[model samples]
Target: MSGSGSQGNGQRLRADCERCAGLCCVALPFTASADFAADKPAGQRCTHLTAENRCSIHAGLRASGFTGCAVFDCYGAGQRVTARPELTPGPEMFAVFRVTRPLHELLWLLTEAEATGHGGAARPLIAEIEALVDGDAAELRGVDVTAWRARVGPVLEEVSERVRRGLGGRDLRHADLVGARLRDGQLRGTTLRGALLIAADLRGADLHRADLLGADLRDADLRGADLADALFLTQPQLNAAHGDGTTTVPGALTRPVHWPSGSSPARHEAPHRARGMPPGKAAPVGGGSGLGGRSGNGRRTGRGGRGRRNDRAGGADGTEGPGRRPG
Candidate 1:
């Protein structure tokens, strides 16, 4: 679950589309698939993008085969990039956005870590990343994101270990368990970081305190699952999976609107306010879920790093692509 007192930083990690300039709609590519109705190349403005920098079809994105748009969280990168006058509506802006997106994601992780009571260890990294994020567009574009991840990934892993300290569950890091049947399993405190869990049957499973960083949950069944306090669980991961009203989530996340209304009694309703949302402001039409970081086959794609599709296709590092849709 989300720790108290991190609400301020959490607000910065969320995408505020009202403040953005349709960067995701213009900078990212989407192939015609079940997730998208048509092919769109990078750097081209989406046809559905309105003159006011909003999605014209925002209200009916999923119904119009643009489910991908509904779940693509920019981690607040879009508004950040748009705020810079030097990088406005050009290749440089998109390039900086590509880099800044992952940096913001790292910020999200660090903030969550601090919220979970690792502030002493997580604060420094958070400060360092914040400095990078606030740098000029040129500096952001030049950042070696791969090297940064290499340094930061271990710290996050350690944080996960600390959070999951006594529960004693399986260490399934990077394990390939796609399509596995694990309904009602006892998985509290399991380390499933980077696990491929696509289409896995996890109904009624206990995942409290389980580490799910970079786990591909697309098409996974989460009905009646206990995910309260699941470490590093993000809105994008929840958006990709199938859950119901009975599926318990962390206090930091809002329930995805796409989830089926269940007959089971609801557990914790966490705050209705979306993370990163401004106080007293309503959530966007689609609830403004996080970005999808998984690929079609359930692999975690890197964001804005070497071998990652910088300013092009695929997801930011450690998450699924922006083009992914509900399963």
Candidate 2:
């Protein structure tokens, strides 16, 4: 269900570390955990960030104890912010990243909104955000996120409404669908935005063009679920969840590299078996050089974590393992 147009839009929402100035590496920090190997302070350059802004340990983040860094996605803000003409490699970049990152995230959602035929409803907010993203550094530095949200939230709500309307009259927005049985269901164009789908069984379900923006999918099962053209489904969401090689993700997305290489029964092979699935679709969850992936396995690192964020107090930010949202 993912047409070419949607895939291009989805790629823009992902973090391209190579195009970034190692902002997430230096601007954010983390505490030692299943995901992170140590406690770091905001504005401190990560030990792994190199002189050229490449992560020295990117390929081995999980092995190095920094899995949280592997799953975090900047929604393309990192590269945009790093493009400032006078930008230099220093702690000052953290201030700019914090201000601009969330705005970029808004673009992620807005892009999904547009892709799902809700562009007209989301256009105003999109234009406003575009102006903000394109504004001078001083204006961006002085942004008021509260006002921005108040103005844009309603448009987001409208976008959600339009998407839900296309889901065969279902309004599953923000629904608590954790551990629920929804196998082989028809769920096209559904608004699952902000829904908690943790550990839910979605195998063999058709979820074409479902708006998954902000939906917490940590540990959700998607063995053979069809998420073709699923809107706003990011690599971070994929990294947080479990899926076998059989899961039909949108062409724009890649399967999380940490998923278990295990193969169990196929749907056609065991049609009578309900809940017949691989116990887990991923290897032990942890951070890599960024958010997470198979550490030191030579497989590409996966998009990485939701950190213990430090937006206002400027405490520390970066990866966290499962159970709690990032600190």
Candidate 3:
């Protein structure tokens, strides 16, 4: 139910590694799990990171056991932090990144809420957050993100309620439904915020208008599920889950490259145009230029790469999931 005018706003929130200083590669830590090939401690650079701040294995992240890198979306915070030369590659910069990452994510969520036509109540908060994002490193680091979330949470919930007013969906916020069998279920307008749906069977489910803010979807089966209008659903969440050509994601997000190819031609074409890029021109996986004519991490090598995906932090349990790093 998002208006077309604001639908394109989400593009600005995506990660643009070209303008970044490889913050995620160095600022965050990852265990040697299914998503990462090796253990990388916080503040230490990944071995794959190159002199130019690009991932050396850009072309083969998933194949190289760096699937976590492939799907991480910084929501544009990496570039924002990199814009300040004084904060480059330092503890202050990383700390600022930790705070700004969630703020940018809040911006994305509020933008989506506005698109829903019920976000009139969210505009003021959006502007306030935007101003905070534009602040200097000192101001940014001092921000109380927990307090901001406390303020923004209810506004988003109100938007969700208004959007799903008549659907009478279930209230399952913060529920532990890990691996539950809910395939082909009627989940329309459900409030699934912060739900742990890791590896749950949601195949062929109807999730239209469901509130998906902060939901952990690692390994969740979304094949053929309808998320065309899911509330607050993000690219990182989509990247973490298993979907196919039959899966219907929101209009703003692209079908993850790793998803089975050649299934949803119509769905595939819209995201490119939506992101203002021509077909097959999105920023290559794991950004930066090298082998296979692709870029490092999830960035495009040179200036021509347009529309990079964003990233998210880990779930509430403080564990790394697909497309998510530890918070």
* lDDT agreement with native, every candidate: 0.63, 0.55, 0.64
For model 2, what is the error of residue 238's alpha carbon versus the real structure, in angstroms, after optimal superposition?
A: 1.5
- Which whole-number lDDT from 0 to 100 does residue 118 have in model 3? 81
TM-score for all models, in order of appearance:
0.80, 0.72, 0.77
Q: Candidate 2: which stretches are off by over 4 Å?
A: 1-13, 186-190, 260-327
Model 1 has a clash total of 9
Per-residue error at 209 for model 1, in Å? Answer: 0.4
- Per-residue CA lDDT of model 2 for 54-144, tens digit only, reads 7777777657766556555666767777877767767556667766766665665566566666667666777788787777776777787
Better of 1 and 3 by lDDT: 3
RMSD of 3: 11.3
Worst 10 residues of 3 by lDDT: 287-296
